[model samples]
Target: MTSEEFGAAPTRGRRLRTVVVFHLADVTGPAKSLRPRLEAIARRGGGLDVLAPAEGSLAGAYGDLGTVCALPYASLTVPRTPREAARAVRSFARDVGLFRRELHRRRPNVVVVVTTALPAALIAARLEHLPTVVYVGETFPSRATDGTVRWLGGRVIARLCEALADRLVCCSETVARQFVRLGSTVTIYPGISRIYAEGDRAGFRARYGLEAASPVIAVVGNLTAGRGQDTAVRALALIRERLPGAQLVIAGLPHPRPIDEAFAASVHDLASELGVERSVVFTGFVERVADVYAAADVVVNPARFDEPFGRVALEALTAGRPVVASAVGAIPEVLRDGRDVLLVPRDDPVALAEAVSRLVEDPALRDRLVAEGSRRVESEFGEEAGIEAFEGVIADVLEQRSNGPRSRSSSPG
Candidate 1:
């Protein structure tokens, strides 16, 4: 069929087969964030194939999610020095071969990629004339804990990805702003999948042996620096004094850097010193996150630096938990202060502690915040909204390709 013939808007029931590629191995927020939507798409009997850099459990986790198929390539770790660029290229070549094989088999209508590991997929999409969407999370090195050299490398790679991607799908407007800064066409606010249910809470809590009445707080995402897990740990210590029985859940992957081992040890020591170590549970990377949300009276995302977009904040809201996130990056866009969530300044452990304490002490305030947070997630970022946003970008990209190139105009994003 001609591109114009397919230009008619897709109806709600239409099945759209798509291929999503992101070379994330092991457990991390972006992988967790993308899985649900891919599962949903798969359940609709549409083709869904994921290309990732993971083996074992990560591969197995995606396998069980839905009809979507998972291909686990040996993950490419960030290179240390400019001299390692050749090694990085070789790694990318290997991943591209895997992706090409998968694409040849699936022949999906659209291509979606989260990270910069899939320039070949972008090229393939261009060659095949298939619509392509690139979901840019916090770019490497920028999001990495490394300093100047890695940052420079990250910028170079990011520039390459920007040049290749047909359309950029940013996790938040803040991330999209970066692409817009580079004169690229982009969409803001990525989608969230609703895998966990409200009814699953009791079972999940029971499994963890959490007390029925203990005030619970959860921190979801990878255990990395700048993510502010330590801030949450300290906040938990301070919270114990106000709400003596408060329990904190630190979930998701452990810290990515070995240097952070001392920091992790310090957090453990701090917890023990506060005498609330027993109350603080570090449940490393739970498969079913809905339960974590269920067992919590409040959710905290205290990322100490700019996160292109904080996915966990939306996840917490989707799970109907009151979120207290740092007022950094795109958080101010996702939540309202004293309404959907309690926003505190970044890097202030005291502020994080006080917010947790306030929420724990006031039940009414907690309830209101949770309700508002849920409403906001449903209204702006729920499954349907996310799907529409994604599909809209695809439609726009396809339309643009069909219309031919025009003078580039600055987009406000």
Candidate 2:
């Protein structure tokens, strides 16, 4: 069989049956964004089944998709001893079995795996003769902390999976390069989702008891160290000196680790010390993120490190709000500094404050950004764009499979 002969079948308009595996127990940004796209795909007459870690948020989120399969998957945290490693290994084995069972039943055309548990999915896809589509939502290995032994083992496994994958979908260009650097074929698919736009301005302001006319600066995401909430708090101190009536509205859950505890405490203490504590409000983890975005005048995503991409920036754009984000990663790709978003250096409270000031003082610039960014997001980075990108990858993979004798990679084969 030759490539040309295999691709002769018209797949340009064909809908494929897909089973997406997300064996992560927690609800991270990536999972939240991917869910709507899968839902949309399922609605379009594509068979969709989700297999997740057999507990917590994953189980609940799975209900939104097709049939849900839950299995054991341990986190890097919790029980760092040798016993924990044994538990993780056991969990991986169980997930492999679950994958096999699902593959047997559905016999899907493609299996979309979304996590680093690639060994099991790759094997199952091979055994079932199913093309595998792997979505790399973030940097592999670096995002989490594991021992040197485990990290090295994971890297080897990831490289093997890369070669075996029929198509790779990454959340950002930075993440896609990690695979591409190793000469693995991949495509850049931005992490995107539709914002929950419901609450009116009055309703949102009342929900948080915020003033109608006060300059409201909103921060959304896990209140982790690298997320740069502390930078926002410090910036608030600077904003107070100029605008005195400025308020900071924080809507996010705290990190699981106590590392953020000290930082959270300091944010409050600094607010009090600067006599601006009354201006600082913390609404810990609101279900409707759009409500917060709607209520705020401006949104800030001042992550200290290079974020793969800032979902909040898109959400703010969706909500018709101006954003001040760090000039890092794929964020710069989405934003045009001073036009769509005000780009600032990461972790610099002074710079964050300056950008915030420009937006607050200049109403024309803020409104211009809000209008332009909203259009950009709706057209380029919303659920619509995400689904199209996903569908494109599926088409390419199936076309490749149909047109030729399969090339096997010994790495994962």
Candidate 3:
């Protein structure tokens, strides 16, 4: 799609009624990143109705924006057993009926599905002939034990969005590449607040009980195996051997899933086994995550999977910290190996440790990476730019719907 297509001004003097659907009820990264976009919509004389699985922090945060409703929906999952397959079918059918009823009651002009995990909303919106936009940020699992099943399920969801939704808004080019056949795929990177650069380092260190002279390495993300918190913990053991006062701060809470919970426990156990428990601090669900960045000498993102977009790296860079991240997915796309950030092999504790240690020892190198990384974020991924792109997508989708059927000459057969 050309810039002209999306740059068309929205119809003036008409309030656009929009309904946004989300799969999760918690205040997740995607939900937080989307807040500014939703606020922009409201500012543009748009009516907002937010839907999620249940009423929780997400609903409460968006209450002022518009009406917040609890609508339980089923997400697509790879079924490994016969029982799971049967359950998935039943849940999907029930969710489609529920979503259809909700859409009918609301009668929105546009339907926005926040994640590809939930396809019931898209199907329902297609049936209602409402313009739909699916925002995809997730990189489906393709390297796990059930890689084949998970990969197949992800392709099915991708095809569903391509066939049903009027537009697909991807968080990164890495994600957009997966929907190569979708004509309306647009990449809009999520933005970070400038507040990250303004955190109080002294206050954060004081509150966390860390000495001013100690070297701190922070790994910020939910506690999960895919996030590679265990790798960081093991790397901490090696890091402490050189810099005895080095501390690893594991930030964020465990997701409310059984696999994530177990992974979190395993990370703690691994820290204990490596005798780095005392040197590692676990701050569960930090309200002000910038503080963790402020208190850190270096931030490590040792992700084990193909991260769709490494938001943690951006946040760290925006906070003026040098990042040591895995060379996976969009990380390398946005950050350079030695210039903006250090890229290490995935799940390699030795490389991660070595990179962190280098940052600790070389102040000039750290300053260079921090400067370059922050500059890139300011120029390309600011909040205003993201909001503009998002609003453009919504406007374009609405315009197309108003003009009747869209031209399929640009789409693949």
Candidate 4:
């Protein structure tokens, strides 16, 4: 059948098979972000396949996936050096060849490119004449951390990726704003898995060697300078004065950059310097994140940078824990100050401590925040809205493609 003949849209009951591609094996980035949606598509009796750097390397992170039909090839996440970037560009042709073979095999209804693997995936989509949707999770004008080299070709590469895609799905309004002038863009806030609500508090505390009655505060995300775990550790010094039994839990490993063991150690040194060494618990890379949230008296997202969207905060709120978050980027949009969460300026340990202390000391305030936070998560940050919105976008893009690709500028997003 001609592409125009297949322009008809699928009804509510029809199935839509999809193939999602990623660049890196990062445990919590685009690959992990889209896994739940892929499962949803499968439950509807629709087929799902994932193409990425390597399959078994990171598949274990998603322990819940009984079977993962992931495709692995030569790919890198955000190239740290110009040589690496140039090499990745050189490898694009090979990636396209591999992608073409996959297209012939699956004959997917649509191709979805998760964060990081942009131009390469886009090239593959166009080569196969398949509709493409790229989800933007990280910032653009992308730069490598700890390196001064400018990815001089980044802008040109980004423009090409934008022009080729049928649609761009951004993780937050802030991310959407960064790319609106490029081409079609839409804000689709990422969703957190509901499994967090099931973690047992007692088991989590026991695993971390935390006392059952201790007031534990959780600061999740990679242990990096930008993530601001130092701020949380420093706050522990101040928190211990008011609530002597208060403890701090740092629940993740280093980021994708050069493993910053020095920085991670520096955070611990700061904790010890503040005389709170005994109170700080570093639970490096726990698989059961829900457990960490459930065991916490309060949760904090103290990232110093403008976080694209703080999914950790959503997970905490979903688990019914009061949140103390940085009021920057799209976070203020996800959570409200005073009502749903206590929002403080980024990098301010004093304010972070005070906010966390308020939740720790005031039982009524904690209860109110927990109630409002869960309500907000259920209304917006839960899996249903995001999954439905993403699925609809993919379906619409495919329909437009099948319709013979008019400049459908009216609904550019």
Best by lDDT: 3
Ranking by lDDT: 3, 4, 2, 1
Tell me how far the alpha carbon of residue 348 in candidate 2 is from the true structure, in angstroms, after superposition: 0.9
| Runs with alpha carbons beyond 4 Å of true place in candidate 1 | 1-17, 25-46, 56-78, 101-106, 123-131, 139-146, 181-183, 191-206, 255-270, 273-275, 402-413
**Highest TM-score model number:** 3
User: Residue 87: error of model 4 in Å?
Assistant: 3.1
Tens digits of per-residue lDDT for model 2, 1-413: 23343244536456556787775665777777677667766776657777765565666775766777666543333235789778767766775665676676666666888865556777667766667877776554443444576556656656777777876677777767666435354554554455445546778788777988899999998777768887899999999899888999888766555777777777778778877788889988677777888888889998875676678898788878899998877788767887789999987899999999989999999899988887787777756667776667777788777765544322221
lDDT of 1 by residue, 1-413 (tens): 33443344554444667777765556565666566656665676666666654443556767664334446554445577767868777766765666665665566656887776557667555545566777777745553456777677667656766777777767777766655346465645655666544527778678777888888888887666777887887787777777778888887665455856666667678788777788878887687788888778788999876877777877877777778899987888777898888999987878988988888778899889888877777777766666666656766665665555322222212
TM-score, each model? 0.80, 0.81, 0.93, 0.84
lDDT by residue for model 3 (287-355), tens: 788899999999999998888888889999999999999999888987778989999999899999999
- Report the backbone clash tally of model 4: 0
lDDT of each: 0.70, 0.73, 0.84, 0.76
The per-prediction CA RMSD against the true structure, in angstroms, equals 6.1, 5.1, 5.2, 5.1
Clashing pairs in model 3, backbone N/Cα/C closer than 3 A: none
Better of 1 and 2 by lDDT: 2
Error of 3 at 255 (Å): 1.2
Backbone clashes in model 1: 0
